[model samples]
Target chain A: MAVDGRDEMRPEDARIAALYRHATGEMPPERLDSAIRKHARAPKDAVKPQKHTLWRPAWRLPFVAAALAVVCASVVTLLVERDGGRLTVPPETPPPDGGETPPFSVQREPPPFSQSMTDRATVEPRSGRAEDAPTLTRKRAEPPREAEVRKSIPESKARIGERSAAPPDGRVLGAEPSHSSDAPASRGNKTSGGNAPLAYSQPPAPATSTSPDRVTAPPAPRAEDDSLSKALPAPSAEASPAAKPAPAANPRPAPQPESAPAPEAKPAPEAKALARKRLESTPSEPRVPARVSALIAELENEPPARWVERMLALRREDRRQDAEALLAEFKRRFPGERLPASLQQNDE
Target chain B: MLAYGEGDVAAFDELYRRHKGPLYRFLLRQCRDGAIAEELFQDIWTNVIRARRNYAVAARFTTYLYHLAHNRLIDHYRRRAPAALVSYDDEEASTSIEEIAGSAHERPEAAYEARQKAARLLELLQALPTAQREAFVLQHEAGMSIEDIAVVTGVTRETAKSRLRYAMAKLREGMQGWL
Candidate 1:
């Protein structure tokens, strides 16, 4: 018969155990024990790892220093790879030169979205952020509206704090920062310079950034033309393209007339003198494009991709503190957006 | 075991001296064949020696030793094919278990009874199914608690307890008139 297997302690368990032990008092013979003991005693059979002096206190400092050096070098290499080498980096511009560029600007050029957006959307201008995030919304609503663009012109110019300060190098106001003929920057600039690059060919033209031709830096009187003409730099005729067809350096001639009278006439003397001094200070450079104020507005409007590029530039320079701060701001401004491929891996 | 893992031969000798008898008797009762028991006994010790360097103090050394014994026994049963050892979850494994016979199984019951009381007990032990006999031997011989028995045998604690309860009940009933 099969027993019902109930799992409970039995009162007779102790008795059964005692009786079983008494009945079966069997043990392994001495021979088996001797054999096992002999096996255990086999020479060098055990696996013991040998201790090394690397962990000693004396070697600690050198080890730590080497580790730090490796880490720093890796970080530098990663940043360089991310931002690109010397050719891609924009010139170092002071905060005033930043001209309301976003809180972070590894770039000196106006980003694609336009300096209008970059200038108006200042990171430090907390008052403007609520307004700035919605600019894209506003642009989306009335992207090509002349009336809308005109309406935004005054407000944008008003927010432009350092639009007057320009890159110290005589590079054209809106031209590439490192535009040496041999460098890749020159090649990129030639292709990417757009309609404005020809206008900015001579850095001397922006020297007249003193004018309303400076592209609405002074809050121009002609609202309609200045609205659309704001995208053009007033004095960028390196090809003398402005002299013949440009009707004198400023491409959009009508707005320039009013801007020239109202804004340029006022600072024309002081600015020209300052532009001349800067021009003399840096001979080999593009020449004082101090009037890059228009370009300043342009640079401020750069895209997230541009900002990331700049952050990489900062990192390549081993400027980690600045890079970290810029990256943090970039993340804050563009939350939930997937970073570019270069930054995405590092982001994760 | 830890000392032996650190290359102390004497520690291994001490462990062998302390555990050999209980382990040997366990195999002897489970197989009920001296030669096979001796073979398994030596193999288990050889395994212990080979594994000494990798041994960790994760559980009682005795439990580790017994776990090795249980696995060896399972392997032995597997080698002697056609006598498939079903899981303890299946209670009706007696038919196949009878095929796991030792030379002792052929001995006459009359001869067993006529001998000493020890022989009578051994005879009753051999009469039970393989798993039941194993449960009884592990409990009474190694003095393992139900929990240790479950871990060593790779079964649940409740199943180990039930096997012990059922084995003891059956053993007691077998010796009812004689004891």
Candidate 2:
């Protein structure tokens, strides 16, 4: 046994070490050594790590290639399936229902002129004719006509006459001739803008007969004439060659004086009854034009200056007619509001 | 080790012969049970043979062999009953060096004092703590330095030195009269 620095150890340390050395002389039995030797010589195959066939390089590449091909095929199939299921429609054709109005038809009721004035200052000019066409179509699709306006004047007149005859509160029932007269003009506007060339080819005679009381009402008829005169001129400049002659022939001076006074001789009491019917039937909820409603919703949180900037941008885009109409609608919705100088200049 | 690792059975046989006595004796003394020692002795050798391919000469072959034997002995102690450990401390249950010496000597009167001294030394070793006893045994039987004892027992060299020092001090105190 190797003792560390044994010769230098204290005498007692040497004697104790010697005693342990003598005691350790007791050997392990020879059988234990034989058993160990037997184990050491025995085959060790059972303990050797086995070689796995699947992880061999020769087999790995083919398996990886097949898996990649399957993934690629699945991705291709998914893309093809997604692309195959959509429907395409052309832009120029009207919807299948022949009477269905094209969304851009200018014949729809103009938004209140005041509302459009506000809109003209703030709203961005619509991008181009293609973009403006769809927006205008959707905007004009619904006109803000009262339920009373939708009914025949005689029916509305009779209903109002009954209410007035009752006079529950003794308030004088005076129907403003403006309400009754505005309805037929709205209808005439719808026909003219929606069916354009077809509507223009027909005489203004039918429009006069449809609401004779409106035709006879003096100021209301002039307002209708003024609106048509203002509206017709801008469209005539841009109208197609085929559509150009139609507006000119349709709005000519010949028809105005003849159709203008047809509603003038109608009884004041009947007109009063119609106006009363309109007041009672008109819903209390304020009706905003669909296009303006969307703009207000979008900009309800925006400042007025931002509204003017957007409208000026719209004017610059060559969408002057739409920008003007939007400004007029904006003015009607927010009355007494002053726009920024730049927007006011553009509006003029 | 390198020769054995390269499939030289004779090299392994030479290593086994050289270490088998000290390694088995170390197990026997640590466990104090013949059958358990024999089992652990075989297991340690079997492990060395199985690990031949990975063996490198990082230390002396004796240190490597005894390190394996030291680990096997620990496993044997853990698996055996705790009662068996208590028996290692029981002087009457343990075989004394005097009893082993007495069997070899024919004249009892001539060897009586030597036998008694051997028996006393054995008792002192048995009374030492298991770690001290292991350090002493690894030192005396395997001729391991404090460094090899620490490697075998997985302790620091200072701890192995301390254990061996304590063991020798106790043994010397017990055998002071004989010295």
Task: Give the residue spans of candidate 1 off by over 4 A.
Answer: A1-12, A45-348, B83-90, B93-115
Give per-residue CA lDDT, model 1, range A216-333, as digits (tens).
Answer: 2221223332322333232222312322332222222111222222221222233323432332333233332343322222223333444556667766877666555566545543
Worst 10 residues of 1 chain B by lDDT: B95-104
| Per-residue lDDT value at A172 in model 1 | 32
Interface RMSD of each: 3.4, 2.3
Question: How is the predicted docking of candidate 2 categorized under the CAPRI scheme?
Answer: acceptable
Give the CA lDDT, 0 to 100, for residue B1 in model 1.
Answer: 92
Error of 1 at A179 (Å): 83
The DockQ of each candidate is 0.28, 0.30
lDDT by residue (B1-179, candidate 1, tens digit) is 99988888888888987888889999998877788899999999999988987888888998999999999998888776566554444376453323323433554566554344456467667666677777778777777777788899888887877786667666666555455
Model 1's alpha-carbon lDDT is 0.49
DockQ of 2: 0.30
| Candidate 2 lDDT tens digits, B1-179 | 78878867788889877777777778877777778778787787778888888988899988888888877777777777777653322123243444433443433344566666666667667766678778888887777888988898888877777777767766666665565
Q: Which stretches of candidate 2 lie over 4 Å from their true place?
A: A1-8, A45-348, B82-111
Separately for all candidates shown, the number of backbone clashes (residues 3 or more apart, or on different chains) is 15, 39
